[model samples]
Target: MEAAGEPIPLSALQHAVYCLRQAALIHLERLWAENVFTAEGAVLHAVADKGGGRHARGVRRVMSLPLASRRLNLAGVADVVEFPRVGGQETPFPIEYKRGKPKLHRADEVQLCAQGLCLEEMTGAPVPQGALFYAATKRRVVVPFDADLRALTEAAAADLARVLASGETPPPTPLKARCRACSLHDLCRPEAVARPARAWRDRMVAAEVGPR
Candidate 1:
């Protein structure tokens, strides 16, 4: 903790780590859009955010809990945390909610790992693993907080801090795939940018070829 009354730095780290343009839109522009995907995600989160404590067998489930780790510069709410006792000692297992099914990308893993790090810091317990529940798939994917993931999480936090401090909206590196599904497609105008770049490159090539 830096000091009392100090604002805890935002963990827009996940946004930056996932996509620079997305981070810029949210942090720099304060713009947001809720598409169908985001709406479904919000519904899932709303159910999880309802505070309640439940016990099943030997596992206790806690919901909508605020968690943070100053060491990791991470702050977020864990959707669900399972505390399982072994030999009369409580161990934490974090669970995060996702809007879609698992993909080839590791963005979701990064988010889950950050949450686990926060749980460890807040509770002073070893959190070796966590899980992400996908609303679309209706399944849970387990994530291990290994050394590599921890390093990535920490680096992401630092990168987010740099971006926020700079207060600059980063230019979008538009990909056809990203543009197709991006919620900010209209705002970003990635296709327009890509077409111009392609045209410029073609003109340069034509000039070099001498009217070819």
Candidate 2:
């Protein structure tokens, strides 16, 4: 596990994209678990890894490519990075594998964009686009590194840093859907912290002073 305030892992950004508290729980507290969802996701990535460094048509496929951006203080592995021969030039395109279908949130996209940033920083070239391969759909969805996505990625990284600096796990999100399927559901106990509680003084007064 990485120490708080150190170079934040790329996974932290993904967690932050889901929920800040969840990110803190995993990154700051070193808590994790595996559920069916996570297990399937791992399987999908393993398949991607086996296809390492192969050339097909004008594309060179590299699997499990390590990436880092010192400027952003983030590090992670890209499931697949494709270098396409376009007009006699090679362009880096990152592809992320997911166990589920695409969601309304940008958690997965932010992760891809961050990979592009790392590639850019290392190669001094702009990564304009990437793709996400969803296990449920088994299709690639193209994502452009426009201004909006770049900003979102940067913000997620910065927020992760803030959460690490504070050294406190954020409270659970109000939306229960986010908690129901998490592997850390039992450990996080979102419902436990959400419940209202009587003050300690009030309990003491009731016990020792008066019932009414």
Candidate 3:
């Protein structure tokens, strides 16, 4: 359970980035509905969460690595972290598993960056980069933890903390592409609520402007 002032879940940061209302629904209201997309994601995670370690090609691979960052107050489990020899020393490299390919949104990248943040805190070593393995594409994309990404991750943590602390569900502003794919679409009913909300906004604007 998470309170307004408690440590935030790393997943919540991703959710917040994707959609604030979605984050509020999941973390604040404890609502969830599994669709095919979510189901596929769950299956992909299931395979990675076996929780063990092994060495491969001189690289030490760890699965289901528990990660926490006191600095950012974020916590979550990494799917896989490979400590490969870099410059004659092992460096932590996190790899996240996703169900789909990369999209326009930066949610997935932000999620992976958050994991790297946690690893740096725990291991007291610099986590310069990570990777995202997309099941749909069957490809891995390397992500550099650059200034922009680190800043975005920090901002997401703050936004998520505020949403959870407020404990209020945000109104729906549905875009078809995202809403249709969301697991909570049935419960969110964006189409049902968005029109009326927009109408109210129009009315309020008219009231403010008088006649213009």
lDDT of 3 by residue, 1-212 (tens): 38645788888888888888899888888889999999999999997889999999989999999999988989889999999988898899999999989989999999999999999889888999999999989999999999999999999998887767776788887888988899998888888888899999999999999997
lDDT of 1 by residue, 141-200 (tens): 889899998898778776666666677676667766655666777877766766777788
The residue-level lDDT of candidate 2 at 77 comes to 87
Candidate 3, clashing residue pairs? none
Among all candidates shown, the one with the greatest TM-score? 3
In the range 1-212, model 2's lDDT, one tens digit per residue, is 45654688887788899988888888888899999998898888887677558887858989888899999999888889999977787889999999899988899999999999999998887799999999889899999999999999999999889778878787775567788877888998877775533354467779997776
Task: Report model 1's TM-score to 2 decimal places.
Answer: 0.83
Worst 10 residues of 2 by lDDT: 193-202
List TM-scores for all candidates, in order: 0.83, 0.88, 0.94
Judging by lDDT, tell me the better candidate of 1 and 3.
Answer: 3
Count of residue pairs whose backbone atoms collide, per candidate: 0, 0, 0
- The number of residue pairs in model 2 that clash at the backbone is 0
- Candidate 3, residue 45: CA error in Å? 1.1
Candidate models: Cα lDDT each: 0.76, 0.86, 0.90
